[model samples]
Target: MTKRRGERPPVPEALPVPVVDAHTHLDACGAQTPEQVREILDRANAAGVDRVITVADDLASARWAAQAATWDERVFAAVALHPTRTSTFTDADRAELTALAARPRVVAIGETGLDYYWDYSPPAAQHDAFRWHIELSKLSGKTLMIHDRDAHDDVLKVLDEEGAPSTVVFHCFSGDLDFARACVERGFVLSFAGAVTFRNAGALREAAAWVPADHLLVETDAPFLTPHPFRGRPNEPYCANYTLRDIATLRDVDVADLASTVTRNAERVFNLGDVVQSQ
Candidate 1:
């Protein structure tokens, strides 16, 4: 049997202050049951990850994410079919997501942009689903969370053509400085994940350092993209502190200050001010 995602990586020391994980996947992290979710959150809280926005990649995961958000007050959700799954996305999936998006705890519609790196779905289908999700986000009054991997130009082009929703965020942002500038100019939030802490991620760090403080966000993208010194290990929300500390250090700012800034940004984007409070 495969090792469960929750089995690896020793939790790091807690941060000086709490911060929000702008994106994560509790299901992929192997915290599916109510007991498992509560335990996972307890460990995260100990590491100062005060709040989390768990995201989904398909219809089933979207349902799980929506339910998880209501399971714990600190948890909120982003729901959509992933780019690769777009080829199989159906009217039923759309209806399910539409209903989930209406729930107060389901705060965003996404992980739903383009992924040219994978051939699971044709470009046309991915683009079609992306446009539909963008519209759903706008209609439901939820932030549009994006997943652009190896398809930056097309992602921007589609957004330009579609007239983006009120709020857009690029989760697990994997772009260079120029692309970062393009996104920032358009007022899209760039969410940095654990990959930013890798040694080969110099360009990513540079992009992050230059992002206007208010436009920057941090995440774990956990059970994957485990941060430096733990790259091959499984990850969980408790590890967000590692990524947040690295980002603060790279930007030459105080960790606590950066924590407050990102927490504020997450709250504003997800409209979670009353939902997740500072610790």
Candidate 2:
């Protein structure tokens, strides 16, 4: 039989608590316009998601994401050029990003870092651009949302050498347990996405078990990595449900308690007080 909201199935554990999706891309996903974004946010809000950090990978989308945040109190913006989009990083792009970061709705400087998976941009160019973004985050004093894929060593090196802002989040963390431990050692927050719910994510689950409650976070990375039982379908902000459930399971904590902890963690790391209050 299907269990109720607060009811736990026969597992001897508490029911999973609902939670806020710490990171997402509601504006870019299926929602191509302001109206669509509004609808998506409405649905997410109804699902018990307290907030979403809508990120943008390019100048146009970044602008759109930032504007969406202005219209919806639950949405916050993180502006940056994804590593794959490094070719589009021009002086004009930098100028636009600088202006966007100055806005109150823009809470972080990223979705930026290395992605050696596709080699979309030359390694040298990506490195240079990553450094530029680091400088931008430092200058703005905003949290940094990093995307390190198949380039953890280089990403960590740059972060260490250049010195990331005090608040740095490793979004959609897919690294091994060792990497997770290393990140925790450096006081970095690891934001897990839907991938954590996949049956094959044993390593991720192990890492999650070790993550400090205060440093752990959850995200949908929506429009991608839809959690299992919903995989292969278009992802949305509301899909954060599965991710939060899985995280609570891994951490061996009640979902409600975990949700409350993560909410505080996201707020502290992303400076969400003013943004959340304004919403």
Ten consecutive residues with minimal summed lDDT in candidate 2? 5-14
Alpha-carbon TM-score of each model against the true structure: 0.95, 0.91
- For model 2, what is the error of residue 194's alpha carbon versus the real structure, in angstroms, after optimal superposition? 0.7
TM-score of 2: 0.91
- Scored by lDDT, the top model is 1
Best by TM-score: 1
lDDT of 2: 0.82
Per-residue lDDT value at 170 in model 2 = 95
Tens digit of per-residue lDDT, candidate 1, span 49-130: 9888999999989999999987888899999999999888788888999999998888899889999998999999999999
RMSD of 1: 3.0
Kindly report which residue stretches of model 1 are placed more than 4 angstroms away from their true locations once superposed: 1-7, 274-279
lDDT of each: 0.90, 0.82
Misplaced by over 4 Å in model 2 are 1-18, 276-279
Model 2, position 274, has a per-residue lDDT of 71
Tens-place lDDT per residue, model 2, 1-279, is: 122422211211222444567788876576777678778776776666757899988888899888988877777899999999996578998999999998888999889999999967888888888999999998998888999999999999998899877889999998888999889889999999988888888998788888889988889897788777666666777777667877777778787898888888988888888765655
Candidate 2 backbone clash number: 2
